[model samples]
Target: MKDTKILKIHNKSDKPDNIVIRDNNLIEECIIIEKSLPNFMKDYFVYLKGSVSVSTRHAYLKDIKFFCNYLVESQELTIAKEICDITLEEFNLIKARDVNLFLGDYCTRYYKHTSQDTTLIYENNNRALARKKSSLSTLFKFMFRNEQLDSNITDGFNPIKLPKPQPDAIKRLDIDEVAKMLDSVENGYGLTDKEKVYWRKTKLRDKAILALFVTYGLRLNELRELNISSFNFSRGEFKIYRKRGKEVLMPINHTCEVVVKDYIYNERTKSELLAEEHKDALFLSLQNKRITPKAIRQLVKKYTSISMETSRDSGYSPHKLRATAATSLIQNGFSIYDVQNLLDHDNVTTTQLYAAHKKHVKRDIVNNFEWIDDKKETSLD
Candidate 1:
């Protein structure tokens, strides 16, 4: 007879916010990927877990996993037969030039066979290549710091030059467009009768969602992770978990207060309306589940597309709505530094990009400050 102890399942509502739970799930994913990697790479995983944001750590681990797979799969370049079998000695043999070719040639374009008759081609731009490089760099640097590497091979790795973001390339809705989007959310303007049916039931909820996005300029995940307790109406503020595990308090304005109150009191279904686990979630789907990022994106697109007078498919994401908020605030004479703090940007230069948005600036300046008399100039011509 074989005897084994029963594993106890302890899943329950213990965490204060869903963001912490989501972050822990991401960390678990990193650990799962790390388990598939070689033993020597475990230190790097621990280092990342301690030092980096959950998303960044996940990306780094994924990149490392891809690289390890590449090392084993590329028969001509590596002696190792599998990723798990890749030893520290085998990894130490990897030269800077080998990595350069892998990033520059292999990562730029690749094909993955899905089935006997199907294949998927993947391409990485300079930004993606740079990220992969940064991942490798961090790994090597960490190992080198601990004397696990023969030398800091990252020094020899060729630098990937990335294109600088230009102000003219920024996409955001102007002030009038912002007003139009809000109006559409409130009144269900331009929605097909079919969409309007759903919109009518969720109008207050939708309005609250859009209002918070535009007012707070929240990242998709940050807003998605909101809990009912995160808001303190009497205090006129809400708490949000930011990147790298920062908890920031954001002041709630009158408009946001009204819309959120309207949704919670009038439209938001609670208790049996939820899937038991998502009882504390701020936004909800028709299926009584916490709203997913994709759903939020689609709603943003629906209203923004109406505002832009574009096709439904041409609608913007929550991020574009974030850009709209930044530009609108800046255009209305708010300090860029203040906007930077509000947006939780690490650099003021990022806020400067929003400040540099020149929507109608050229024409407005010319129209308001015409130095030459148009009639005289026309007669001379």
Candidate 2:
């Protein structure tokens, strides 16, 4: 009898999607860190798991761990050797004044001795300090409410005032720069011989990635988690998962449609070289695996740096690309509320930042609506 080859099907739907799995991993990591802390931390852990996102929970755990380590290192408690050994009674001994010292002084600058001859110095800006303060405040409040601590000393903790972010402070590509970036990806404008080799293979994919970013203003993770099934070309629509577990449908513009279809039909559809595990992924690397966030960041930097004629290290991040989309849409007379919907901004105030950018508004007034120029005001004579 002739042998029949049984081709195995890659059923990605049988398993949880990437976002859920990534979040679950963070939750598991939080659990591990929580177990290493004092038993009373369980209450806070459970609360955070239910109320907050996994990333925030993990970050809070890290902040708490550092604070606990600081207590032991500073000789403030003198009794515990490690965070796990710090008892509830000893924990209760910490006062708001001590927290004030940690946040105000130690947090501003710190040192870690990696080896006998080597050390690393760290600095935290006001924003980072504020978040650390918030993490501590949440933990302190939880402990006080549970009667696990001696008393509420949160009121005494010093405030960390962060400066308001101005519209001028936001960095994004101008309209012409956006076109140049795409052109560079398409035509290899300034790529070196070494980069050109890889560029030839990845240009279509890179173009599609950049197009989706400038058009939809998708976040780093949102773009990273896209799958082939996420796009419905027949309807000119695609799905993106946003923060707080939001799934949004985005309309595919002409540029995105053309570039994406070119990449999919011309390149990505050649599945013979693809890994079974990454079969459903919308983007792939030279290794035939799903693309990583680091790779996307590097590619964006390479293209944007060339487009802006800047150093590679000074290239903008994915978030800045998001800012580019917002400002571009607003500059083209799109409504702030509508841009807010596309960008999935939590509030219109966030979208208002892009709208607040001073593009040609000041220039237009100075050149055309000028009162000081007497040559244009002949009626005044």
- Every model's TM-score: 0.91, 0.90
Question: Which stretches of model 2 miss by more than 4 angstroms?
Answer: 1-16, 358-366, 369-381
Per-residue lDDT of candidate 1, residues 180-206 (tens digit): 988987888888999999999899989
How many Å off is the CA of 127 in candidate 2?
Answer: 1.0
The clash count for each model shown is 0, 0
RMSD (Å) of each candidate, 1 decimal: 3.8, 5.7
What residue pairs are clashing in model 2? Answer: none
lDDT of 2: 0.86
- Residue 184, candidate 1: Cα error in Å is 1.4
Model 2 residue 245 CA deviation (Å) reads 2.3
Q: How far is candidate 2 from the true structure (C-alpha RMSD, Å)?
A: 5.7
